[model samples]
Target: MTQSPLHILEHTFGYREFRGPQAAIIDALVTGKDALVLMPTGGGKSLCYQIPALARPGVGVVVSPLIALMQDQVDALRALGVRAGFLNSSLSPEAVRDTERALWAGELDLLYVAPERLIQDRTLELLHQCDIALFAIDEAHCVAQWGHDFRADYLRLNVLHQAFPQVPRIALTATADVRTRQEIIERLALEQAEQFIAGFDRPNIQYRITQKNNPRRQLLQFLREEHSANAGIVYCLSRRKVEDTAAWLCEQGFNALPYHAGLSPQLRQHNQSRFLRDEGIVMVATIAFGMGIDKPDVRFVAHLDLPKSIEAYYQETGRAGRDGEPATALLLYGLEDVVKLRQMLGQSEGSEEHKRQEQQRLNAMLGLCEITSCRRQTLLRYFGDNLAEPCGNCDACLHPAETWDATEAVQMALSCVYRTGQRFGANHVIDVLRGSEAEKVLQFNHHKVSTYGIGKNLSAGEWRSVFRQLMARGYLDVDPEGYGSLRLNPSCRALLRGETAVHLRKDAKLAAPEAPRRSPARDIDPVDLPLWNALRACRKRLAETQGVPPYVIFHDATLREMVARRPVTEAQLLEVTGVGDSKLARFGEEFLAVLRAEDYEGAI
Candidate 1:
């Protein structure tokens, strides 16, 4: 007999209730219906499909793009006492055949296969002989050609519907704008799928964006103050930067490692393994590092350079604080970062419309950085999601940015761009405005211009801030063909002519580095610290024996609960949020023993 979704969710997954639209999505899938789900990270998206897979008869064939994480994903399920296995290149031929036989014998509840492997004719033929419950396409946004992370194999996923017309199919993703959503529907032939948008807000993450000034030092201070000894990701725009940041962080006594496409495959895999298996390993990487990572307790994600778009930013930062704990997303960006991104965009071999869309996305990212209001509000508005009130956690809400009437400064900066023949970048324009006698200023005879000495009151840094704000607010445009020169937008005519006033956000002064005021981990009482360490040690030992990451055993939240509630019996242990029947049976007594020994003084 088949179990109900709620029964599976509680007995198998140890959750009493569904979060957000999980129950509805699961019901639709269990009843042989299609679905397209857009849920944020840590929003329990997996349960929407996993529960249905278990509740329904036959094996759930999950088509995922994360080939590297297939083992971990299946391991997590197997830990839940669900019969789960995966078929990918990582498995040996013998192992693959074993998994296939298990599926044939109806011994597996779920089977994960990468898109590249699933598209194989032999794999499809083998699946045709098996009892299939449903098909789930993970990371559905990869189907969008213009998205930040596009996989060609995702384009061929429409075959799932054509081949398995009688089987229910669901597409799931954590990040998608309206355009990307439509693209997924079209590309995956999911027009008939019921859409479930769980909104794009990650309230547990604190958004903190600041202007770049000695970014290495700034990142150092941030790590020292808030995230010292916690696992996090530090993103850089280039491989060289990733290497340098990783090395510098290591020199500063951090357990940092570099990961980029430039690294050898073996080395990259080694570093990634260390990051997942070891505690407090900071992986300094380029954009290539974050997709498919299932680590839930990443306390922070810092960016030494600006991402190209808000979508990319949201997706990357969402990796942090996935366990629903307080986490930080710190981005330190500068005008040069913007220029570099635009230059790369301009050189792309995309259609004019595609480039235009990309530019708009970049502009939106810049707007998020410069907005003086709540960062979460502006970020959510971009995704067509609305927060009724300000999120009181972002840097903007905690310490509001000061705004100043910069109408005169903006007008002067615009005038300087115009007087410099519109062929100069912000540095040249600012130099001209501040009456600099640099050779470039004299070489172009810019000193003779009327605007050269008119803005001597503001410092050069101040003028750069003004120009950056102007660009961010759409008053100024960058000419990529002209080598990133500054040009005034026609909309700026009103401000230049004094018909409109401009108010720009003043950059906050960098504060001195200090230790974190509070702990990034759960707020356990000092008396409970010993038990907390004991539970963590037990979890680590089990994880090592099982050859999985520590988090795969149990999250820190779960351990904290074990410490607080002190569950002594099997029934009491099952009451913990993450403690399901499988976990309780497999490791319940081990944990109960630790809890019973309240005076256990083992150090972590």
Candidate 2:
């Protein structure tokens, strides 16, 4: 059997060899078999369609969702000497016309179009005239109503095959659950297409969700630890928060910028460009900042507010560590996030069915936050995937979560809430528990309550944990209808009767309680910014080259080591922390070249 030179060429211009589903996906497309690729965020997904598009006869049609992605992908492809162009709202009419002319003239290798534009009759008519190789639906999960960035325009993608039935179509998405995958299949009318699910586990990402007590300070700590690398995305719930957080981050002397729907398109583009091209810019944005985005070196993804679902969480966290080096997803939440989220949920304008599905999604996100077991396990389970053991990469696994029989403490707490007339949230109730003689305690006469001064031994943080855990464990519920008052749940009866043990797990801190003091300015990697960047370019090129996902070769840790060590030989590579024998032998040559050919040395 003759190997198609696409496999060989894949290594040449692209970088690495194909691994796992990549070759099969390329083969499926090369053979004109329509396919759906359900790959994780950093899963070498772009190559599945891109390589085959370049390998086979004519221009590959890639239907992308975001304007930023189209620009960046085209730029990257052009850098590697592959002809690429995009037709989206961002392009002028003349640009779109010239791109269409190029498509008809067969001057471009890959053509990316927004789904809305792809659906237009004029575009379809022009596409029909071209010797189209394949139709690649990027971000295919947007077809589902259950998706975080649902695009009604994606529903039109199904008609593509009907118009150009002979052309093979490959639908792809970075994050899609079984439901969303199925929806993409049905909607695209590709039921017979081969389904390729690259591994969902992002082993390099350290997944963590911290309680949102003083999120600003907590965010500062994460930046301190991870900012030695490119500062990562900090996602907030609202446009206001995005602006506020971005401003605050800048004040702290980080090159942070804001991006949200509310921003002028020019500003959003400017912020995105700064993040994409420059190093160490923390783009504080809403979820709008990252879909279909191809930024491989985002060191961390911090959530300043609650994410709505497991899919949304997976997609957002998935953005970090895409380069397969160790990145972090630091999510900060409080009990009030649920209330605030549910309030937002309750206000959404949609069919009742949509609302119900959204509620289920939010509930799943809340469960992930509340789960005491391995967080990665819960996250995988939510996507209808399974993991055998604790990930050992998340907060729960890093520090084994502590659980105490809170049956008595919960009983006292719930009974106290009930006695206090069930009108107060956790803070006020905790005030009563610790016998705070503050004005509210004295005015409401909570100081005289039976629970007052009974738990003075518990620290303020510990008491907050008790309340959060109580709410999570279902002994209490936050009544969104009642200004977030703590209401006694039916489980409280069993706890109050001492028949059931109310297990309360302590909320883990942002950093270890005993960790050393950190310098605010020390967060920036003034030491080796130039070196780390070259290693990052290595990761990105290697990811693009071998059809094998970037993370599989060497994690960000290994790359950082190569940069920090300036490893020039295989032996030196072995000495790097994350570069084991197999990885060193495999990627040693590529990485050495990356280090030797360095402009970033002066950047340091």
What lDDT does each candidate get? 0.88, 0.76
Over 4 Å off in model 2, which ranges? 1-5, 8-12, 347-353, 435-460, 512-604
The RMSD of every model to the true structure, in order and in angstroms, is: 1.8, 6.5
Give per-residue CA lDDT, model 1, range 375-411, as digits (tens): 9999999989999999988888888889899998888
By lDDT, the best candidate is 1
**Candidate 1 deviant stretches above 4 angstroms:** 510-522, 602-604
lDDT for residue 249 in candidate 2, whole number 0-100: 83
**Candidate 1 clashes between residue pairs 3 or more apart in a chain or in different chains:** 225-516
Worst 10 residues of 2 by lDDT: 513-522
TM-score, prediction 2: 0.83
